[model samples]
Target: MMRQRILVVDDEPQIQRFLRPALDAAGFDVETAATAAEAKRLAATRAPDLIVLDLGLPDGDGKTVIETVRAFSSVPIIVLSARDQEIEKIAALDLGADDYVEKPFGIGELLARIRVALRHAEPAGPLPGPEAFGPVVLDRDRRTVTRDDRLIHLTPKEYDLFVLLADNAGRVVTHGTALQRLWGPAHKDDAQYLRVLVGQLRAKLGGEAASLIINEAGVGYRLVTS
Candidate 1:
């Protein structure tokens, strides 16, 4: 089997030393870059399956590097950083990172996150049963969604969220879990977006049918079943 490639970009030599052996042992082809510039160059050539980045880089901040790479790539990125601020994490996730770990993280947890990030990134066919509830109806296989027998417009993110939830309808999807899976680990605390999104979804489907996607207090949201 071909080894999965993982890019590790950090200014700290210690990070490369600690992460390389661990990743190699896990059967990944490890590539190391000491600066953001090098990371970008390596990413362009190697197209690594995942990236481990430190927020503080020698050439530039990790945010810039992330933006640079994300301009064209949807590659999974896990940010390793010393900063533990909630806003920082949310910003990174919102910008398109796959996950994040605070400094002094466990190798085991990092490995676990990598597996999850990759698992969720895998291609998925549309779910079965023709996604529908109340006024919304989506034929996954046909790539069609309708409201009251008329097509409804959806932005990519909105459609992504709808498909994810519709795929597992009538089940409770925790806010933290959904945000992490869809947006990234950094967005675990951005529950406010959930409310905003749900409201918009309700509006798009018409106010009368808004209850199809129910909110679970103190936990998360779920599709209304009963």
Candidate 2:
């Protein structure tokens, strides 16, 4: 069987030192790049199965790398960065990153998220048609969403959260469940992540459609279907 390839892009030598071995031990064929320029070049030539990207690089911002790679590829990207600000996380996710891990992270958690991302990336069997909740519509198969016949752009995480709630429309999706489904078990207690995603989802949804996602307060959220 061909080993799964992973491209690790980070400028920190210490980070490169540890992640390469950890990923290798976890059975990935690992490659490393220390700069955004290098990462873009390797991504073109290496065609890695997934990319572990860092936000700060010597040559340019990691978001640029994401935009560049997303232009030509849908390869899963998991960002590893020291920026723990919610804005940074939201920005990265909105820019096409599949996942984000804050620095001072546990290798185990990162590995688990990697598994979730890779599994989610696989081609699945046929899915049901677009689901409608009022004006918002989500086409699961195409992974596209529309509101009032116009397209609505959602980040990967936002889409996941939307789908989860959409799948259980009119019912409460506890914060823990939503978090785990979108961010893995390790993030079950990280309600802030879900909150930020929901906030962004609401912003793009706009107006009354934004209110479709109801906050349950210290409990979870509900996608009001009616």
Candidate 3:
């Protein structure tokens, strides 16, 4: 089997040196680029399965690399940057990054995030029936949610919110994306509405099942399958 390729875009030699062998040992064919220009060029020409990008690039902002690559491919991009500001994370995510890792990160955590992104990028097979996470089952065809065989009633908006999180289980769904999808573009900035809706949904899900909806704080929420 061909090893999955990872494009590592970072200006710091330390980071490159740190990740190359670790990623290689983890079974990825690794490629490195130090500037935005190089990153974009390699991304287009190399067709890597995934990319680990830094926000601060010598030639330009890393987010632009995300925009440029996203224009042509749906390949997963993970932002590995020192910037931990919420706005920076939101911007990277909204710009199409599959995941974000703050700098000084542990290799183990980064590897886990990479695996999740790759799994999500894989083409999904058609669902055989209702999707179950823990005791909660979401029947998309019937538009119903149930917990331990008992029906759990949800409002239309709440159902939509739940479904969105469920669809991207184990991945953080940014607030901007969620708002824009659940509400219209006009209401995309309305975070309070999302908070209220989540609270309501959590109440309905109840007990340990409600805990499945994990909050990403300033980012958004992720539905934990495990």
Candidate 4:
């Protein structure tokens, strides 16, 4: 497979300076743009697998760029900005940004999210039929969850989490991974939200099924292997 390319667009030369070399050293085809016009120009020729976009572009609003990009592609977009307002985050996510991140973030977390988006953003084959993990059985295609045939209702995010956890039944999944898979980029550090959601999932799954989802303290969560 070709080394995945990422277009990192930000007006801040400092960000590009720091990120470009890092991404290149890490083996991605890195393209940098300081303005939305320049970004659109590059994007026209090369639709990257993922976009690490900054909202504060010089030429135009980043939201417009997002709209323009979504017009032609469903490429995964992870918004990077200093804005921390809920309204700002909601508007971006509602407008089709897969995720958003505030400034002053650790690059490792960003990379983890990027990996997840690249892994799951593409099209896929048919899902599994009835599948068992611990005491819960899920039919992925039908979106049905049951504990020994008792029905369970999961929110969209919860179901997505369930599927990912089920797919990697025995592996430890970092809280960041779960947030990336479910809430996208912006919520990775919001581990508390995930904690509550996981707690709710455990309650719904009942005691036995609940035990399968284990917390790993400050790291992440894991699914106990049967």
The best candidate by TM-score is 3
Q: How many clashes in candidate 1?
A: 0
Clashes of 2: 0
The global C-alpha lDDT for each of the candidates, from Candidate 1 onward, is: 0.78, 0.84, 0.93, 0.79
For model 4 the local lDDT of residue 155 reads 87
What's the TM for model 1? 0.61
Better of 2 and 4 by lDDT: 2
* Candidate no. 2 TM-score: 0.60
TM-score comparison, 1 vs 3, better candidate: 3
Clashes of each: 0, 0, 0, 0
- What is the TM-score of each predicted model, taking all chains together? 0.61, 0.60, 0.93, 0.66
Residue ranges of candidate 3 with Cα displaced over 4 Å: none
**Model 4: clashing residue pairs?**
none
The most accurate candidate by lDDT is: 3
Arrange candidates by lDDT, descending: 3, 2, 4, 1
Off by over 4 Å in 4: 128-137, 141-202, 206-226
Q: Mind sharing the TM-score for model 4?
A: 0.66
Q: How much is 205 displaced in model 4, in angstroms?
A: 3.2
